[model samples]
Structures are given as C-alpha cells and as structure tokens.
Target: MLEVTGLHVAYGGIQAVRSITFHVNEGETVALIGANGAGKTTTLKAISRVVNAVGGDVHFCGEKIIGVAPHEIIRKGIALVPEGRGVFPRLSVLENLRMGAFVRDDKAGIAADIDRMYAYFPRLKERADQLAGTLSGGEQQMLAIGRALMSRPKMLLLDEPSMGLAPIMVQKIFEVIRNVAAAGMTILLIEQNAKLALESSQRAYVMESGEITLNGESAALLHDPKVKAAYLGE
Candidate 1:
C-alpha cells in the first residue's frame, strides 16, 4: 500500500538517505532493520513528510505524497509512532488518545475506537486518567501506539517501539504489533532489535548508510549469514 523509490534526504549537505527503494504491501508488516546511523529513521521521516526528500518519489495507495504536509499525510490514513513515543506529557491517557482522532469528526466512532484501544491495552485503561509522563516506559509505548490507533489509520509507521523497555516489555510490544497487523493494518516498522523485528515481520530490509542493502522474507533474512552476523549477533 506504500511505495518509495530512489528516495533521498539531506540535512543541508549531509545526505541521510540516498536512493533507497522499497514497498509495503497491504496488510503486511515490513521491517526496516539497520544500525544506529544507518538512516532507518530518516527514511520513515521522509515518508511521513517530517523531512523533505531531495530526490525520488513516495506514493501511498497510488497517489504521490512526496510534497504533502505531515498532517495531510496522516489524514490520508498513515500514522507514525515515532522513536521517542512523542506523547503529550501533561495530558491524561484518555486525552492523549483523543488527540489521535483530531483529524476526524466522528464522535461516535472516536469514542468506540477509544474503548477498543482500552481493550487492546488494559494497562492503559487502568491509567486512563493518569498523566502520560508518569507512566512506565512500557506503558508509555503502549499509550503511544494506542494513540496512533485512535486515528484509525490504514498503515502504521512504528520506529523502535521496543526501544528502552525491558525484555518482557519488548516481547509484549512485539506481540501487540503482531496483533495489530493481524487485524489488517499495514505496518512499516523501523527497529534496532533485528531478532524481534525479523520475528514479527513478514518481510525485512537491511539498510546501511542511507540505502537498502538487503531485502527478503523475514525468515530467510533471519537465517542469512550476513544478516545474522551483522545485526542478529549470531
């Protein structure tokens, strides 16, 4: 449902992504795996229009989206749960979730989605009135994903959803990711934890120095010698 071709991004002469191409089909979970400076996040930001691409094109569901505004992109059924979980610190959990539906006017649907989110994340329901900043890392990540889901997006962009959480939390987060995809939401995931990412996604891409170096089925990539040695610590 999403296509990116020859995508390039630069930070005033420092090119972060150079001619990378990839696609995520409908209802698929595609993982972008790479090291810290491999420009994985840059690629996502470019797709989300948070950063401008200097070259190439990005299309979502057959329409060009390279120059569109970020909010416009979100309204077109794409939402990004950024690397830092970018939640509103002072807002209550319920309030944070309501922000996700800011672009929508369906009060009934929004309320129903909120209930669904609470069901999907029971911990969030328990802390529904608590300040987002006070939640634990795992809970905050849950809130972040929950908030994004409140927008009723067709595709979700997740950047390091497991980043700072304990192992159990990481597992739980991946489980939620898997469930989300199973429920028919397309996902383009950027993850540093190769093992978890590969396990959760159907297909995976290995990125380096702002380009795609490898692409294959997740299981195949997981067993590949180079991918295992470089990213999986095998």
Candidate 2:
C-alpha cells in the first residue's frame, strides 16, 4: 500500500508537482493519467525519491518514506520502471536483469525470478545474450518491466510503459501489466493513454498543471464528461 499527501516537487525554480494526494491499496493498480507536463512522471519520481519532494509526505507499507534514499526505497519493496525504459543499453538482456537484483543476495531466488520474467516476456528469453540497446522499442519496454520485477518488489511504479510503441506492442505490454496485477502486484501507473490506464486500473487520478484535479473509481472516471472530452478524445 502507498499514500501520498499534499506532495509538491520542483526543479530549480520551476514548480512541477503541486499538492498531489492519492493512495494505492494493497493488490490494487492505481493510475495517474494526464497530458504532457501534467507532472505524472514527476510525482512518481518524488515517490521513488529519484527526485526529492519539496513538501508533503509519502508513506509505503505504513512507514513514512519521504526522505528515504532511492536504493533504500527498493530495499523496502518498491521498484520504479521509469519513462523511456531506462535500461542499460550496453548490457546483455540477462545482465540487465541481473543488475535489477543488485540490492538482494538471494542467488537461488534471483535465478528463479529470472525464469519467471522470461515467462512473462518470451522475447527477452530469445534475446538473453543480446545487447539491450539493439532490441526494438517494445522489447526494451518489456525488459524494463521484467527488470523491475526481478527485485521482487511489493509495489511497482510504472511510468509510461506504452510510450513510443506500436499498437500491437502496446497491447502486449498492457496484457503483461494486467497479468501482473492479476497475480497481486500493487502498481502505481503513470500513463498518457487514459483509456487503457482507466480500463486496467481499479482507481484513477487525473492531473493537470502539477496538481490532482479529479480522482475516483476508474470505471466512473471513464464516463465522466470532462474526462471523456479531455483525455478519451471523445
């Protein structure tokens, strides 16, 4: 479970995220959907401590994690798959996955998780020894998600898993996400595709110009006139 209250983030003098509050329950997939510059990615970065929050609080599993170091955040059971699929381009697919488990020393468990990742992403298995940079965009995204899963995280922060991919590949990526959620992974997803995000998540938040503007059950948000007009392109 995760809770973020009155969160604020800034870069130098630019205020990026303002007073964003939301929660994701255990085994639930909560989505933050918005247009570019809406601060969805910044909010996730603040939650993961990749970028520090200037104000407010973040709690994970009942403890305040606002100031925790990024690596410590992982140790506490949260993993972030950032926007742009920040995979180690030079590393082999297998090696990239290995790096994901860097915070852990469970050799047997890590290896088993690698196998599980392969199951979730068969393309990765085929490219096990290949350089990650040489893979297609969609494959790289899959690798990013698989790498995050390697950490055996209690919750996943996914930022734009469908970005820059073809329609079929995006469908594949969302299918994997749905399967992961079905298997009880708690996910906080930041996505530009509002329809997909709302459809896949239990609850949703809409952000505009650095703040949360609307939030509710995803199904209800999907039909709201404003959401349909602005995000669903109706």
Candidate 3:
C-alpha cells in the first residue's frame, strides 16, 4: 500500500537517509529497527512529509505523495503517531481525538470513531475529560495511537511507540498494534526495541548510518547472528 524508493534526506550537510528503499504491503506490518541516530525516525518523517526528501519517490496506493503537505498526507489515509506521543497537553482526551479528525467532515462517522477509540482503549474513556498532560506515560502513548486511529487511516506510521514505558505497558502497546494490524491497517513501525519490534512484525528491516543494512522475515531476522548479537542480547 505504501512504497518508498531511493529516498534520501539531509539536515543541511548531514545526510540522515541515503537512497533507502522499502515498501509496506496492504494489511501488513513492517518494522524498521536501528540504534540511536540510525535514520529510522527520519525515514518515517520523510514518508509523512514532516521532513522533505532530497531525492527519491514516495507513493501511496499508486499516487506520488513526496511533496504533499503533512495534513494532506493524513487526508490521503496515512496518519503518523510520532515519537514523544505529541499530544496537546492542555486538551482533553476527547478534544485531542477530535483534533485528529479535523480533516474529515463526517460528524456521525467521527462520533462513531471516537466511540470505537474509547472501546479500544478503555482508559481513554475513563479520562475522556482529563487534560492529556496529566495522564501517565503509558496512557499518553495509548492516547497518541488512539488519536491517530480517529482519522480512520489505512496506513499508520508509528515512531518509537515503546519508548519510555514500563515493560508491561510496552507489551500492552504492542498488543494494541497487533490488534490494529489484524483489523486490516497497514503499519510501518520504527522502533528502538528491536527484539519486540521484530517479534511483532511480519517482516523487518535494519538500518545503520541512514541506509538499510538488513531485510528479511521477522522470525528469520530475529535469529540472525548479527541481529542476535547486536539487538537480541545474544
């Protein structure tokens, strides 16, 4: 459903992603795993148009979307749940979700989606009127993913969803991601927790210094010698 080919991005003279290529098929979960500053986040930002690619192509469902505005990209059925959860601190849980659907005009559908999100994350329902900043870190992450789902996206770009959470909470977050993918949403996940990310995804890619260094089925990569030693604590 999404294709990135020969993609490149730079921060002034510092090139972060260099001619990277990958794709996420419909209803499939793919992961990008790397250490700090490996360009995993930059790749997602480029796909979401938060950062412009210096060269290469981004196509979603056969349409070129490289230069599209971030909002437009969201409208085209792609939503990004960035690292740090990026929620509006002062906004109520319900209000933050409403912001997610700002690009849509279907009031009834939006209402239904809000209800669905509440069902998906019961905690959000309990804190429906609470300020987002007051929620616990795990709750805030759930809110971020739930807010992205409010847009009813066909594909989700998740960046570091497991960062800073307790182990149990990280497990819960991955469970939600699995359920979301099972419900037919394509996902391109960038995660620092390589072991969890690989275990959770169907296929995975490893990146280093802005380039794809490895790509394979998740299970295979999980047992790969280098992967085991470097990421799996082998």
TM-score ranking of the models? 1, 2, 3
Worst 10 residues of 1 by lDDT: 169-178
Which stretch of 10 consecutive residues in model 3 shows the poorest summed lDDT?
115-124
Candidate 2 per-residue lDDT over residues 1-234, each given as its tens digit = 799999999999989998888999999999999999999999989998999999999999999999898889999999999999999999999999999999889999999999999999999999999999999999999999999999999999999999999999999999999999999999999999999999999999999999899999999999999999999999
Residue range 1-234, candidate 3, lDDT tens digits: 999999999999999999999999999999999989999989999999999999999999999999898779999999999999999999999999999998889999999999988888888999999999999999999999999998889999999999999999998889899999899999999999999999889999999999999999999999899999988888
Q: What TM-score fits each model?
A: 0.98, 0.98, 0.98
TM-score, candidate number 3: 0.98
**Model 3: residues with Cα > 4 Å off, grouped in runs:** none
Count of clashes in candidate 1: 0
lDDT of 1: 0.94
Candidate 1, residue 81: CA error in Å? Answer: 0.2
What TM-score does prediction 2 earn? 0.98
Q: Each prediction's Cα lDDT score?
A: 0.94, 0.95, 0.94
lDDT of 1 by residue, 1-234 (tens): 899999999999888999999999999999999999899999999999998899999999999999898889999999999999999999999999999999899999999999999888899999999999999999999999999998899999999998999999888888888989999999999999999999999999999998899999999999999998999898
Winner of 1 and 2 under lDDT: 2
